[model samples]
Each structure stands twice: as structure tokens, then as C-alpha cells.
Target chain A: MKLATPRRLILPGLAVAVIAGLLSLLAYPFPDALEDSLESHRPETKAAEEAGPRPSSEGSEGWSAPLPDYSVPGVKSEGLGGALAGILGATGTFLALLLLLHVLKGRGRRGPNG
Target chain B: MHIPDGILAPHVWVPLAATGAGAVAVSARAARKRLAEESVPLVGLMGAFVFALQMVNFPIAAGVSDHVVGAGLLAVTFGPGIAVLCMAAVVTIQALVFGDGGIAALGANVVNMAVLSTLTAWAVHQALRPAFPNLAVAVSTVLGVLVGAGGAAAWVMLSQPYGAKFLGAMMVTHLVSGLVEAAVTLAVVKALRASGLVPGDARVVAR
Candidate 1:
């Protein structure tokens, strides 16, 4: 089978990386929305409402559930930063992989295949 | 699902990290032996493909979306070692670049999706190879999808001190997603086999 040239492959790979990076940024806001949705409908909160507030118990102080705070202080900047980072990082990795493949191809050509 | 930083408990993250490290080490050694020089570019491209595919999320019930975890498909096409590597790279890129997942939870994500899924698929492929050689790839792909999704749900359930309703919701949502993943994996494997990207002659490639 004819191997795909590094040049031929890198362009498409780079395109994919860029797209993924952008999508990640676009979806960053969605997480907060999701968190809000989850929090509002949280079972614990629902249960607490259904059953009247319990008396403060000594043992329960140490047993609070650890839920993450998904609220972003500055949603706009954080989303942009995340998108830029993702795009740059993915592109860098794709380029690095392409370079490696190019080097390997050269070595293979110089070996027995020559 | 990419569990962001501060979401998963430290105990869960630490143990998963250890497991992921071990799996990655083993996969690296195996990859060195199995992956050809020519395969490197293709593997990288596959990583890109997986990255793209993961972004296309389908809405599940309750307004949540789930994406395909392609580890099993990669394993069947590229062997377990390379598949794991591909998955780890994809996850790493997703976490660091996009902030989709927490850096601290990276180990847990890798272990759940990459290591467990690929290894389980590889095992299923091995066991079913003799009886249903032609169907081995399809069976393994489906099994991998199921195992990865179920295993992930199980991990989340065990890790979180949540009620049964939440656990059930997570598990059911993943189960549906797994079915979609299985179909996609099967189609990809069949297409690759038809196109000769994966050798049609099972005996030659199986070795």
C-alpha cells in the first residue's frame, strides 16, 4: 500500500485540530449551563425541600458532599483563552507529528527501500 | 465525559493516575514492536480523526450530550498499544488545550476510556477470534463500546457519593451512547477492511 505523504496528511490533520479547538471553546459555555441545570435539579436539594430542614447534627458537619463550583468569574475571557490554547496546542502537536513522520520517511527511503 | 478539575475526589484521581501510568508504559513497549514506521503518520491522523469525532456530540435525554469514545475502534484497527497511545494523546489535547477536562482528572479519564476500553476490546477480540474470525472485529468493537461506557459509569457512580437516581441516569445515558459508538466502530472497521487499510486476510494481520 502506498503510504500517505506527510505533507498530504498534515493539512487535513491541522484542519481537524483547529476545528476541534474551536468546538471546545464554543462548548465551554455549555458546561456552565449544564452545571446550572444539574444544580437546580440536584437530588439532594430536592430531597431537602421535600423533607423539612434537619437539625444541625455534629456528625454531619464533616460529611458534606463535595460538589464542584462551575461558575466562571469571567466567562468571555476564559472561553476565548481556552479556545486559543486548544487550537494552538493541537496545531503544535499535529506539526510535531508531521515532522516526525517526515524524518522517518527520509530514513526509510535511505535504508533498504533505496 | 471529561470530568473537569476539582470535580473528582483526589483519591479517585490518584489511583486512576497510577493505573493509567502503568497502562501507558505497557502500551508504549507494545507499540514500539507493532507499529511500523509508515504507520506513524496514519496513527497521528487517526488521532486527529478521533479528536474531531469526539466534538460531534449527540444530545441524550435530559439535555445532556454524549460523544463517541473511539478507543475500541482504534484498538481493532491499530492494535491495543497504538490505540491506547492515540486515546491518551487525544485526551491530553482535549484537557490541556480546550480545558474540556480537568488536568488533575486526566489520569482518571485516560484509565477509564483509553486503557480499560482498548484492553477489554483486545481481550474480546482474542477470545472470539477462533470461532467467529470474520466477526471478531465487529464483536470486539461492540464489546469495547459497552465495556468502556459501562465501566466509566461504574467508576463515576463509585467515585461520587450520589444517590441511585443520579447513578441510574448516568448509566442509562452512557448505555445509549455506547450503542451509537458500537455502530460507528463497526462501520469504520468494515470500511477499513473493505478498503484494505486493515488487511482482509485476518490470519496475516492477527499474527
Candidate 2:
């Protein structure tokens, strides 16, 4: 199995990422159904409440992601930061997953021809 | 459907995680068997594309927006096996790298978005393709999102108090989101066909 060149892979990925990054600026930021519903907790939910207080911070209890909530760290422009984060994320995903697929493909090749 | 942390009982997410892991293993095996050497890049690129598209969330109602999952498109283009693998990767990345989803809830997210969506798409497409290929694509794409959302709603009802409202909101918004997802999925499938990026012979393995 062969891999695509950085240019071959990155170019198309960048094109898509840039558009997505830019367009994400317009995405509605309101809480979704799950979040909204969670907030509308009924007083009757003694069971849920007793499970434990909502974690003081959502990701604080676990391994925190570098780009929490898909936003870039220390960027003044929320929109631009989110855009850059999206671009970075797409590129990172491509490289990481490509590596994974590369390994899997290599294993497949080795099984028969190695 | 992104289920954040601090929601869902341990009993719920834990089992879903196990199920997701099993499904991922099954899909990975299926992928290695069906995927050709050259198609590795295709799967990688398709995963990246799905990741990118998911960032652009479209508002489906007054308060909520949904993103293009590419679940149906992936299943249609690559096969159901690869589709599951690709989406599992996409969702994992979104959670671990972007924090778009919660760590505890990742499995439930996968169960909803990856396993269910891909399988539903594959089945619906197979059932509908004999009569109308385009309609099959449309319906499969729509069903993939809707059914996946149903999985999400189930988890929410278990964890949260407002099941009726949550179900209502998710279903109504996702119904519209599903239609948009269908249109985009159909358009991309057509483009892939026209460009000969996805050959007819490549679609393999319903699982």
C-alpha cells in the first residue's frame, strides 16, 4: 500500500477545511436538545441530582482536549480561532487517521505477501 | 448527536461503550478484508472530509443545529464496514482532540452516529436501490441521521428529566436535518460517481 503525498492529500483537505472553518462562523451556538433538556431538570430528579453534583467543570474530571469546544486557545477572534481550530483539527485528523489506515493496510499486505 | 460529559448514568454510557468497541472491532476486520490497497487513501480522505463537514452545523430549528454526518455517503461509497470505521474515527477525533463530545459519552456517541447510522443506511439503501437509486440514496441518508438521533434521544431520556420535550425537540429538528443531510449526501454521491472516484465495484460488505 502507498500513501498520498502531502500535497495530494493536504490540498483537497485544506480546501474543504477552509470552507468549513469559514462557514462554521455562522453556525448557531445555542445549547442543543440534550443540553437544554439537561438544564430543565425537574425537582423530582432526586435520583439524578444525588448521583453527584454536576462536575464543576465539564472536562475537568477527565483528560481535557487541547481544543476544548473546538476553539483555539488564546486567540482574540472567536470566529477566526474557531476557523483555525477547525482547519487544524481537520489536518490533524487526516494525518492521524491516515497513519492508522496505513498501519492497517500494511498489516493486510503482510498477511499475504510479506 | 454530541452527548457531553456529566450526563448519562454510568450504567448507560458504559454498556454503550462496550457495544461501540465491539462494533468497531467488527468493522475494522471487515474493512481489512474488503478494502483494496489503493483504497486506504480513499478511506482516510473520506474520514477527513466527514470531519471537516461536521464542523459546519446547520440550524434546523429555533435553538438547535445539526451537521452533515456523511454516514450514508460513506456507506454508499465505500461499504458499511468502512463507513462505521470512518465515522468512529471522526467521532473519536471530535471528542479527544476537539472536545466536541464528552469522554464518558464517546461510546454512546459512537453507537448513535457510527454503528447505527451506517447499518441503517446500508440496509435502507439496499432495500431501495432496486427500484430507484437516487431515492434510495436520499432515503438512506435521511434514515441514517434520524435513527442515529433516535439513539441519542434514548440516552438523553435515561439521563435527563424532560424526555418528552427532548424527544420532541430532537425528532422535529432532526427530521429537517435529515432532509438536508439527504440532499447533501445525494449530491456528493452523484459527484463521486461523475468523477469516478468511487467505482461501482468498490461498495462491499453490508456489515
What DockQ do the predictions score, one after another? 0.13, 0.43
Model 1: how far is A9 from its true place, Å?
A: 4.7
Which structure among the candidates has the greatest lDDT? 2
Q: Give all TM-scores, in the order shown.
A: 0.70, 0.88
**C-alpha lDDT of all candidate models, in order:** 0.61, 0.77
How well is each residue in B1-207 modelled by candidate 2, as lDDT tens digits? 788887766878889999999999888877777776665666777787888888877777677667787889888887788889889999999989888778888999999989898899989998988888899999999899889988987886776554576677677777787899899988888876664556543353221
| Lowest lDDT 10-residue stretch of candidate 1 chain B | B198-207
Tens-place lDDT digits, model 2, residues A27-111: 7787654455455443256775676424234433758789888888899889888988878877777777778767766777777
Output the number of the DockQ-best candidate: 2
True contacts kept of 1: 0.12
Model 2 residue pairs with clashes: none
